[model samples]
Target: MERTGGETLLSLTIMSEYSETSSTETFSTFTGLGATSGKLIKRVGTVVVNGVDAILIRRRLNQLEATLGVWSYSTTDSEYVKSLYNDLLELSRPVYKPPIRLRALRLIMGRIEMMRFEDLATAVANWPISYSYGLLKTMILCFRDTLPLIDMSVGIERTEALVAYHYTGSHRAQKPEHCAAFLSWLGLTTSLSTPVFSRVLLQLDILSFVTEIYPTDDHLLRPSAIRFPRQRLLNALLIGLEPVNDAVLINQVHRIRTIFVWARFLNPPI
Candidate 1:
């Protein structure tokens, strides 16, 4: 069937959109049947592909947003959540512009914030260590956009669990890269003036805090080789500790001092 160029182009465009939508549906099926059945199916085809040809990407994002909106916190499925996390991570990669990538990240954090506390912990615990770390890095990169999406009103237990799961490796052995990323995330989150941020800091176990700071090896300990901001970390801790009582504040300060003193002695220049 010979056709004009415009007609051919239009046909190809329609086919591309259909293919991309089909791919998304196929991906969803492997994650779980009926996980995205009702409202999700309705929202799947609404995003119009523009000149950017980001139809698939935008469709995936829309699907995730819709899923999260309809997601059941009480009967949450860990594998289903993990699949969503994986998709959000893929969308947050460099292939997308900062806006799109950050939006994906924001959604990732939003999903974390939206989960029931127990489900949040279990889901994070079951996730691959690398996947958890990737999620941490996404939050770090989109600090401002993602931080407030976390519902601090969920109370200290959930907030601490969220931090511990991603940052401290509550379910797995901690990696240097994970620790580095955690500090970056903590540094940013603690910079806020709210007392809730302070309370979140206090909820952390001193052991996890020390482990992150203790410098696992020479690469991490070297003065010139430190990967995270030492002074800023100290400042964040101080800012966070400000709202605590004198006795508790004193204890935290002393604990922080022990690590920093050792760090400074090892790296005398700082």
Candidate 2:
């Protein structure tokens, strides 16, 4: 029988609490005692049905599990891993509805949550709309908390807080901007264009953004266009603003001129 999302999570939770130290456990302990320590990991199979896609998902999950095994887990780390697993399980739900959405929100809002950024990114790509809907809804909930609920106001402050609270970074160098890139990718997937998304997109490397969001089209955003601030042109790309359009070409020309003008003023007659 195909395992339900809830079943998958329950099984993982039980496995994590396994007390009997078997041969595999001994091997894990030995591996941890080595020069390089390890993180707790559970073997998870693909939920997708397509054979080729399932193979890809399995391979990716293995890669993530391998990488996760390199990190040492404390009580807090273990909790974070559990939260991530649960979050993904919720995101993996095949039939997204109000009940699932509420469950996802309750988990997110009930506590400060954490997850592997890469895993979250992978889920954003691989999960079904129902899952994505829940994930995005949870994000929106977090975003709500950051703003003053007095007038029902939400802004970048709320956005930053949400990003910080959820995405604690998979590595040292992971920053708000990288989190933004992940969101930008998610936004592209879910058609969620907002001020927060734009802010995040602006902070991402142009090539990285294009490659992840518009992989097949390397030439979507021109070098000249990218030299301008990301916000100035991000909407154009997201909105499918045709480069061949006379108005867009004219705007690009004007933007390039403005950049040159600013450069000249900043370093006049060096």
Candidate 3:
């Protein structure tokens, strides 16, 4: 069906690839506020989103960004800054491509430029943190053919980061060991398997930090392209690091299973 407003129509064709649901519960609550969700509803221009119908969705996206920015701005009157931030990420499932997607990110940045969460600087502050995610995202984009998210970032640290980690090997040219090269290039890896308690969405905290990161949910891991020893590439996070308790190890195993499921979903032939 088509969900339209004025001249544009939103394609409801978003399937499992584009799970039209927020990955976070709090994010959904914020987006559900209707018009209070901000300016993610307007189309800045002809944003060529691949999966969903590009008409109404673009406008909705713009409104979403505006709403998030306004809500999260420290001085903004809205009392839901944290609530809205979570919502924006939750609504990020149908995240757009560069120039287009950049619009929303800029809005988020504008709102939170002066803010820091949990006393830790923003993820956008450091490139290693962001690049690791970006590199992961790039590989995901390759798998999904989703969208180009190569915008390095802005600031001195980002500049230093780009210089140090701008590019290294033949990760893109399909050379031998590209997968190994890429993962090794990433240095320390973070888990993206599932959400943890208390911390909500910590990216890389191992001690008492609950995050749902790992290869399972991340569509761009390129599991097929990565051909290392099963225990090394597949269970790198667990095996590479110093051995932990059996309970934590068991949790990691469960998350790995999630990755296998998604990989199979992406490439059924495997």
Candidate 4:
């Protein structure tokens, strides 16, 4: 039977709609499996893609850097930062080539440059610290064979300071093993400058003090603790050690030393 012209057009429209929807879903599913995989496959599928892998990786890395930088500097949008970091996990998937992995490492390091340690510590305090650490460790391991390709001192310093700050703010018992491992890593790297070492040491001391006060069961910094005068003393210990060469700092250091001696004698341990 010959179909009417109107009926034939209607059938064609319906088929077109179905085809469009199906194609959209198929593409979405392919990408949803993993951005890394989808991107790599697309590049490999073409003979003239022209460094498509580097292009895509660089784009994602730039985005990740900007997202984290804004999150750090803005001091808001913890949820948004959390989602972005979560989404970025796609790049770390195992299927990517070594060069791709290397780019991922470089991106990770790039992102670290924008980190505000205090802000990030508070932002992810309640979330699992292991997730952040694991991602960092993965990037570090990926670049292990090509260590000469990147300068890791900056990243390592930032990671140590961040880990120390995060643990201190977390109000949990300081993990000695974790601290030791960080120290070991630092030793393996080029020696940190005096100021950097001093700052990290102070952070570690703060971590120890925090653990002592709150112990393992408590996970929140109490207002009473913050208001305590000892906290000020601890703050003085850290901030006063900055490499500023000023008479005020000299006096402040002298003052802190004097106060420490008197406090030690006056508040002798029971």
Query: lDDT values of the candidates?
Result: 0.46, 0.36, 0.35, 0.38
| Runs off by more than 4 Å, candidate 1 | 1-174, 216-227, 243-247, 266-270
Q: Candidate 3: which stretches are off by over 4 Å?
A: 1-53, 70-83, 90-95, 116-270
Q: Name the lDDT value of residue 80 in candidate 4.
A: 48
Model 2 C-alpha lDDT per residue in residues 41-106, reported as the tens digit of each score:
222232322332233233333432443433333334544454344433442343333333233333
Q: How close to the true structure is residue 4 of candidate 4, measured as C-alpha lDDT?
A: 29
12 in model 4: Cα distance from truth in Å?
Answer: 20
TM-score of each: 0.35, 0.29, 0.28, 0.28
Ranked candidates, highest lDDT first: 1, 4, 2, 3
lDDT of 4 at 2: 21
Could you give me the TM-score of model 2 versus the true structure?
A: 0.29
lDDT for predicted candidate 4 compared with the true structure: 0.38
On TM-score, the candidate that comes out on top is 1
lDDT of 2: 0.36
Lowest summed lDDT across 10 adjacent residues in model 1 is found at 37-46
Summed over model 2, clashes come to: 1
The regions of model 4 sitting more than 4 angstroms off are 1-59, 69-75, 110-270
Candidate 3, residue 24: Cα displacement in angstroms equals 27
Q: Looking at model 3, which ten-residue stretch has the lowest summed lDDT?
A: 193-202
Better of 1 and 2 by lDDT: 1
Q: Write model 3 residue lDDT over 1-270, tens digit each, in one string.
A: 322233332333333213433233244334443332232222312233444434334545565556544433343434455444433432332234444444434443333222322211222222233333532343322212112334334333232222222233233433223334333222222222211210111222321111122243333444543433222333534443334434565466457545566666876552
